[model samples]
Each structure stands twice: as structure tokens, then as C-alpha cells.
Target: MNALAAELRGILQGPVLVGELLGRHTTWRIGGPAELFVAPRSEQELLAVLHLLAQVGMPWMALGTGSNLLVRDGGYRGAIIHMGALQTMEFRDDGTARVGGGLPVMRLVRQAVRRGLAGIEDLAGIPATVGGAVVMNAGAGEQAMAGVLQGAFLAGAEGMEYWPAARLDLRYRASAVPADRIVAAAILRFSFADAEMLESSVQHRLSARRKAQGVGKPNAGSVFKNPPGQQAWRLIDESGMRGRSVGGAQVSEKHANFIVNRGGARAADVLSLIGEIQETVRGRTGIMLEPEVQVIGEA
Candidate 1:
């Protein structure tokens, strides 16, 4: 271990795991070990860890639920800060919530439903952290975080500060939030709604997702962003790439846009399959599909 690793292990308020396999953390169930993995219990601890990382000039990456991520087989050389321990969830007297970025988005959805709040009912099915959702503007159809997110708390070299949602430039499964900073928390504004109506909407979305997606398999949700006026699944299906397989990775037959691990898929297999789909779709439709899934680390 290096001097920096030695110091961090001694000072951090949480576990500093060495050679931690990322496959155990991601939804895809694939990836090699990270050089160091830290799960800070409080915002102060998180900042301290980041400060130490900056002092040593060691690269670091923020980890959410790893829903839409692909970490390569060679693993990441930098430190990974898992935000699961930053699980604060506070509801206000007004119809808004102050949530820890690490809270599972669906858990937030359930809380909102219980509170008879609207805005994120349609997002009940997405497997993402609130922080990840904000970064990607995760949504389905016409509903998205942009509609409810009021502001975010960001921490980086400049220290922690709040930025309103309008300033974040969120749009279409993407956000302008800098990749280097960590989202510590967010404020979401919601409206009062009939409890029955909210529950109905949540269930409907969840059911629709289960029916349309590959449910029993381990996979990130969608592999490609839908092009304007065209769904990615439709394009992939039209290109005759449905059910395509590369090693253990397979483009889901149930939903052509999702790539699933049939049991033991490697990150390389998933990447190769994504490439094949992109090539075939572009060749057929003259439109390129952008990947919604974030790929990281090495091959």
C-alpha cells in the first residue's frame, strides 16, 4: 500500500476496502476489483475522504447504485466512494423532500406515494440512486427529475455548495453537472395528490416495466437512449439485432434495448454487444444511437 492509502485507512470514518470487486456492487454483476472502496457514513467523512484523495493526487469516482454502469474487467485504479451510507431522507412541512443522494430512487418513490405526493410516481420502477437520477435525469416518457428536483448539494475541490435544478441543465437522460463532483443531497418539490391515484400510477408504471423488460435476468435497464421520434428498442428490433449474444451478454429478446447477463457476462462481452447493436442500427436507419449506460474503468 502507498502512503495515501495508509493514511486514509487510518482516518476515514468508514471501511476502506482494498481490492474490492465491483461486480458485487453493480446491477450487471460484472467487473473487476477497485483499488480502494470507501463508504462514508456522513457528509463530513465524505468530504474528508475527498480531501485526502485530492492531497495524494489519486483519482476517485462516485458510486451510486451502479444501475446504469459498466466497469471493465481490468478494474478501476482509483478510489471509489460508495454513497450508500449517506442515507438521509427528511420530509418538510411543505410538499418537498430533502433527500440524501444515495437513497434508492424507488425508495423515494414509495415515500412520496405514502405522503400522497405527485411528480415522481412514474419513476417508481427505475433502479437508480437519487444522485444518479439527477445526474442522468432518469425518467420514463414525459416524467423526469427535472420536473421535481429543486436543487442539489455538490461537494468537490471548491467545497460543498447548493445549486438549483434550473442551473444544472438537465435534459433527456443527461445533466450538465460536472462529472468530477459528488452530489451529496437534493431537494425535490412535489405536489399534493390523491393517495389512491398516486398508488395506481406507481403500480401501473412498475407493471408496465416488468412486462416490457427482461425481468428475471441481471441487466441494467436500457442500453441506448431513444432517438427523437424513435424508440431505441424499435430501432434495434428493426435492425435484426434482437436476442443477439456475445459471450454471456445478450440483447434481451423481451426488450431489445436492454443487454442482459445470461449468467456470467463479462464487461467486454457487453461492450462488444453494444457496439454490434449500434453498428447494425446505424447501418439500417442512418441514425446513431447514444448509449444511456455509463461505461467505466479498463478492459
Candidate 2:
């Protein structure tokens, strides 16, 4: 493992940080250090890093913008691949667009809107990269990646490959992409619309979100998935869990489903708060809360 780590450092063209604190990368800003971190810039560099890690059978994980993730206090033992520099987007003469996985979701939305594309306007306030959005099928049922994604380019043990959207089997907040595969880029299809219409749609969604969501603090978006026929926030609020705190982690008063970091919170604190919400809500409503946020690393 040590030998592989050394060799990895020698070959990468992008920045590599050893013992990089994960708190700096995540939205909640509350994780421990990662043993090794690499941000590869191009397809060649990304493939190189993946190949080297695979050769050693070293465990690794990809991090996008870290919008809906949590890293524990004990930290990740393997490589932390940050796909930030793979920011490429090409709009075709046809209605299809090619987007790099690392490009922010809103950035693509804005560009597409300017080009008179309309499909992604509802995804305006979703804070995630294209890759992350596709992997998790990010966005609401009214407008989501599954609605427009044609296919995705991914890198895995078999090297680079394209998986059509049908093969992905995207579900609510999930995709069946092979665990070994990491999304590299995506092919998206959108409808033509007037630029003014797209702009108005984007602004409307953003305004609605701003009114309904908590702001001015660090949060990992919605902490729990809404149960069948029940909104997670409503359930949490009914259970009187809003504004509840565990250490520095608290359920946002404005949005019960959001867990915010009230500064200097630990991963343990967030986990504890989540557990408490689950227990309380379950006891009150007979429905166990399922987390929307992906918790990784060790406790």
C-alpha cells in the first residue's frame, strides 16, 4: 500500500495532497483527513490514476462537490479522487449536449438556458456536479437527470465505457452504475425553448428554494429521504425535532429535514443528530427515516 501510494504521487500531473482534511471538501465542512487525495484534470490523467489504484487493488472513492455526503471522523483509508478539473461542455447542433462530470450543475443549466434549452431549468438550485447529479438521479420528479440523460461515459476496471441511460436504471436518488465505475461525462437531450422562458423558469425555481430552504449556514441539504406518501420535513416537524441540536449539529428550524453545522461540529455530532431524528420520528410516526445523505469513511 505504501509503495503504491508513493508511485501514485510520482505519476500524477495534478495536485496531490497527503492527509488532506475532508472537512475542507464537504458541504457540511465536518470530516477528518483523507490519507491521500488527487484531483486529476483530464481523461488521460483520470484513467492513469484509476489504473494505478486498480493495479494495487487499493480502495478509492470519487468526490464531486460533496453536496450530499458525510465523511466520518476516523477518515478514509484509500484514495480520495476529486473530479473538479474535468469541466467540459459542448452543445451540439442537434438538441444533445455533452457535459463533463466535474462541471457544476447550475453552470450547465445557465449555459443551456442561454442557448434556448429548457429541460434543466427546474434543476437550477441543485448544488452538485453533472457526475454527482447523474449518479444520484438528482432533482425532483418534475425535473431530474433521468428525464434528460441519454448516456454517461464512465471509467472502471474495463477502462472507459459508455452506458446508455436505460442501462443505468436510475431511481429515486440512486443509479445502478457499477460500484467500480466512476462517471466521467454525460450525453444529455433537451428541448428547445425561448431563452426568456428558460430564464424565468430558472429564476422561479431558485426563488421557491430560497424561501423553503435554510440558508446562512453549512448544511448537507435534506438529511432524510421522504417516506412513501409522507414528507420527511413535515414528519420531523410534527415530531418536534426541528431546531433540535446534538453538539454543534442541529436540525434547521426553517427546514426540518436539513441538518446544519452550527460551527465546529464533528461528524459524530451530525451522525448522532441524525440518529436522534430517526428514533424520534419513528416512535412518533411508525415510519423509520431513511437518510438521503451518503455517509462514508469510518466513525
Candidate 3:
């Protein structure tokens, strides 16, 4: 272990894993290991760790639920700041909910539904954390985190600061949250709705998602972004790449945009299949497919 990593272990109030297997954390169930993985229980602890890392110029990445990431087989060389322990949620006097970064997206949706809050029902079946959703501007149908966000608490070397929704340049599936900064919490504005109506809406969306995109396989949701005026799944289907397999990874037959790990799939298998799909779709349809899933670590 290095001097900085040793210092980090001493200072942190949470469990620090050295050479932690990252595959278990990610939704794809791929990746090798992280040199250092720290999960802070509180915002203060997270900030302190961030300050120390910045002072020493140590590399780090803020990991949420690991929904849309693909860490390479060689593993991540830097520290991973895991946010799974920061799961706090509370309502504000202004009728908005303040949710911590580590809170699961599905849990938040359920809470909102119970409180008769609408707007986030579309995210009922999405597998991610609130921080990841906000950073990626995650959405379905016409609803997105961008539309319901009031403000966000961001932590960095300078400490925590609240930024309004306007500051987070939310494009289609992207956000303006600085890459180096970690999302601490967010204030979301929700509309009052009938409890029964909200519950029904959430259920309907979940059921539709299950049918359209099978919940049976172990997959990382959508792999590619939809090109302008074109859906990614339709394009892949047109290219006849659905059910295509590389090693143990297969393009989901139910949803062409999703890549499922049939069993014992590795990072290399997923990447190879991704490349093949991209090449095939591009060569046939002339539309370049862009990956929505973030690929990290060594190739």
C-alpha cells in the first residue's frame, strides 16, 4: 500500500477495502478490482476524504450504484469513492424532498409514490442511485431528473455548495455536474397527486418496462443512446445484431439496446460485443451508435 492510501485508511470513519473486486458492485457484474474503495457514511466524512485526495493529487472516481459503468479487467488504479452509505432522505418545509446521493432511485420513487408525489413515476424501474440519475439526467418518456430538480449539493476540494437546476446544464442524458465533483444530495420538486392514481401510474410503467425490456437477464439497461429521430433498438434490430453473443455476453433478444451477461461474462466479452454491434450498425445504417454506458479503466 502507498503512503496516501495508508493515510486515507487512518482518517476515514468507514470501511476501506484494498484491492476490492469491483465486479460485485457494478450492475454489469464485470470489472477487475479497485486499488482502494472507500464508502463514507456521512457527507462530512466524504468531504474530508475528498479534501485529502485533492491535496495529495490522488486520482479518484465517485461511484454510485454502478448502473451505467464498465470498468476494464485490468482494474481501476485510483481510489473509488463509493456513495452507498450516504442514504438519507427527508422532506423540506417547502414540500420538496432532500435526498442523499447514495439513495437508490427505485427506493426514492417508492417513497414519492407513498407520499402522493407524481413526476418520478417514470423512473419506477430504473436501476441507479439518485446521484447517478442526476449526473446522467436519467429519464424515461417525457420525464427526467432535470425537469424535477430544484437544486443539488455538490462536494469537492472547496467543500459542499448548493447549485440550482439551471446551473446543471441538463441535455438529453447528460448533466453539467463537474466530473471531479461528487454529488452529495439533491432537492427535488414534486407535484401533489391522488395516492391511488400515482400508485397505478408507477405500477403501469413498471409492468410495461418488464414486458418491453425483460427483467429476467442480468443487464446494464440500455447500452447506446438513441440517435436523433431514430431509436437505438430499432436500428440494432434492423442490423440483425439482436441475440448476438461474444463469449458469455449477448445482446438482449428482448431489447436490442441492452447487453446481457448470460453467465460468466467478462469485461472483454462485453467490450467486444459492443464494438461488433457498433461496427455492424454503422456499416449498415450509416448512423454512428454512441454508448450511453460509461467504460472505465484499462482496455
RMSD of each: 1.1, 1.2, 1.2
For residues 161-277, write the lDDT of model 2, one tens digit per residue: 999999998899999987788899999999999999889888888888998884668998999988888999999999999999999899998899999999999999999999998
| Least well predicted 10-residue stretch by lDDT in candidate 1 | 1-10
Runs in model 3 lying further than 4 Å from the true structure: none
> In model 2, how large is the Cα lDDT of residue 170?
89
Looking at candidate 2, what is the lDDT of residue 56?
Answer: 78
Q: Rate the local accuracy (lDDT) of all candidates.
A: 0.90, 0.90, 0.90
Off by over 4 Å in 2: 1-5
lDDT, model 1: 0.90
TM-scores of the models, in the order given: 0.97, 0.97, 0.97
